[model samples]
Target: MRLFGYARVSTSQQSLDIQIRALREAGVKTNRIFTDKASGSSVDREGLELLRMKVEEGDVILVKKLDRLGRDTADMIQLIKEFDAQGIAVRFIDDGISTDGEMGKMVVTILSAVAEAERRRIFERTNEGRYEAKLNGVKFGRKRSIDRHNVLSLHQAGIGATEIARKLKIARSTVYKILEEMKVT
Candidate 1:
């Protein structure tokens, strides 16, 4: 049976070196390793799709961790079921879990639920923190580079949006947005 490795990271700034090294050490060939720099919540990963297409029956898929496969419990369980149906085995080296038998299946399910719960908790905490910040008068999003009053005055002075943008050292789109908001254009 062929051994294929999968690795993923949520962002471009995160390194894949540790997972790649572990896969290599586990006997997964360098060329057999597929990776993606994407969030585990996303299932539309190009690398993962390619790996799924390339794997055959009896082939084994190795992942560094269960969470590396996915954060959504249903999606992760569905993927494992698909692999199982195809006579393929998924092994998570870090978690010491595999879909090889009944016990393995149960363990995987429980762990998947826990992972999904943790993800939800993180999301709720983030939203709570943002709500608190907003209540404290903390402004979100990018700071305005140009004032709406200035743009309106310039527009009233017969300056076109393109000229106003150039004069104000801002994009024409920004000038247009300001004008649109004030209904001056």
Candidate 2:
């Protein structure tokens, strides 16, 4: 059976070095490793799609952690079922779990539930923090790119959206939005 390794981080700001290192330490070749810098909730990740196409029957896919595969239990279970049907096995490095046997399948089901619960806890905590911040009168979202006065002044000066965007160092869409807000030409 061919061996493949997958690594993923939720954002570009996060590093894949740790996961890659772990995969390499497990004897997976660098060329056999696939990685994605995307949230687990996203289904259009290029790296993951490529890996799915590359895997074949009797292939073993290795991941450093279960979260690297996905966070939603239903999605994870569906993916595992697909792999199981294809005679493919998935092994989590840290969890010491593999989908090659009945016990492993049971553990996967339990762990998927735990991962889903953990994701819910994280979501709840984030919302709680946001609620607390709003109660404290902390403003969020991007500050105004330019004040309304400046936008009106620039619009009246015959500045087009492109020029206004360049001068204000903001997106052309933002310039148009500012103009639209003031109902000015």
Best by lDDT: 1
Q: Mind giving the per-residue lDDT tens digits that candidate 1 earns over 1-185?
A: 99999999999999999999999999999999999999888788999999999999999999999889987776787788788888889999998888877876787677668767877998999999999999999999999767889889999999898999999999999988888888874
Q: What is the Å distance of residue 92 in model 1 from its true position?
A: 0.6
lDDT of 2 by residue, 110-152 (tens): 8668767877998999999999999999999998657778767
What is the Å distance of residue 45 in model 2 from its true position? 1.3
Worst 10 residues of 2 by lDDT: 71-80
What TM-score would every model get versus the actual structure?
0.59, 0.59
The prediction achieving the highest TM-score against the true structure is 1
Off by over 4 Å in 2: 108-185
Q: Cα lDDT of all candidates, in order?
A: 0.89, 0.85
Predict model 2's lDDT versus the native. 0.85
**Local lDDT at 62 for model 2:** 93
Candidate 2, residue 183: how far the Cα is off, in Å: 42
Residue pairs clashing, model 1: none
